[model samples]
Target chain A: MATVTILGKELAVDADGNLANLSDWNEDIAREMAAQDGIPNLTSQHWAILNYMRKVFEKEGSAPSIRRLTKESGVDTKTLYQLFPKGPAKRAAKIAGLPKPVGCI
Target chain B: MPSETEFQPIQKVSIVISKGSLDGVYPGLIMANGARMEGIEASLFFTFFGLDAILKKRMDNLKVATVGNPGMHMPTLLGALPGMSAFATKMMKKEIEKIDIPPVGEFLTMIHDSGAELYACRATVDMYHLKREDFTPELDGIISVGQFYEKAAGGQIIFT
Candidate 1:
């Protein structure tokens, strides 16, 4: 486990740097986490991906793979990488307070 | 007893795939895709028969080497029976799809879209007289072994 201070509140994160508690996540925290990751601004495109990941996680109990994200998130693979940067599925899931996706494709 | 500074994390990987069977090809594809998912640079060089993985006509129809593979757990003679390879391939494809892994064509697209470089070996392409149009559009280019070595520099090189 690890801790990150976001919005002046200390929060626990998992070993993979994902939020420990889904409820600990909010728009402010997502923005803070994104900023901490060097995405200084979260565009609506970014929110779309994050929101889609959260919705899928809520339903599926895990984050969607990159293929699913690209196919269903209304985001292409290139733009996903641009929005979340290297490892789009993993990073987007982290920012969305979802577990790391377990699928290989 | 090496110093910690000598143990830097793997930043890149160059994989050379020289076999064309479904079993032979998927390992390299999986490794390359896995590397990209880790934010590490990945490049795949398809040589010899492995070029089939990139060749549009053959990529989707790859079969498992049922006869020679000891892992098949059957007699080699029985493995040589016609339709055995097809049956095994069908079963494997089912298992692969059950796990949500895409077919070779779609998998290549996903890997390419994720920014990993895919290359077909120039020497083999020349030997086989394969034209550029014969390969998938996802291919970055046809490159020589020298070029492969150059790209592989400073990274771990894996042959599958």
Candidate 2:
């Protein structure tokens, strides 16, 4: 397990699943998270999304389908899509502190 | 690094809609709409004054602020003077409608129709004396700040 500090809080991230250097991503996510006070904690749901984003990046080197993610995560397809303006994989990946996937631009 | 070779799929996004003004509301709506188009699970937690846009009666009245809002640029400024605010709002409404994007009411309706979760802050609801009926019928429910945070974990969180 690797620890990353975000918004003055430290979070434990799975080393095996983490993308790139853990510290770098942690700082970036911390800054992003700190921008808003409305969202306070990191939950399993958030992690599941992040993990999925990383997996998609690794496989296709790009974001995956909302249809596939909805089926996979069992979340509503529309709700899933709304979470990432740039697409689920891209937005979630950025928030998860993972690197930008290929073909995202 | 070899570690970078692995890929991940993003599953969710958490957004906070804080400004109720027309300009303020657009970013949140646009982002939320964009997210839906991409198939990501997204939620918007409306707090403080931001609740105005979701309120049944006030939604259509959302206006762009000309004087103090730093985010308002040239086109928006030109649109806010004299009768321009109304004209600008009308034009914006027309453009969105042309693209089949719903008005704030319908846009939000589509969001709910698409299964996007909407939360009105409990504190704000009480502060404003807003009954459940005051908001759009599609609201998923009201949540405390803590509850909102609990839901925001792990995914990307945005504030607009």
For model 1, report the TM-score of its A chain: 0.92
Candidate with best DockQ = 1
lDDT of 1 by residue, B42-121 (tens): 99999999999999999999999889899989899999999999999999999988876789999998888878999999
Chain B TM-scores per candidate, in order, are 0.95, 0.83
User: What tens digits encode model 2's per-residue C-alpha lDDT throughout B93-134?
Assistant: 787556445568867865665557899999999998889989
Candidate 2's displacement at residue B138, Å, is 0.5
Candidate No. with top lDDT: 1
Q: How close is candidate 2 to the true structure, as a TM-score?
A: 0.55
lDDT of each: 0.89, 0.67
**Top model number, TM-score:** 1
lDDT of 2 at B108: 83
Where does candidate 2 stray beyond 4 Å? A1-105, B1-7, B70-82
Clashes of each: 0, 29
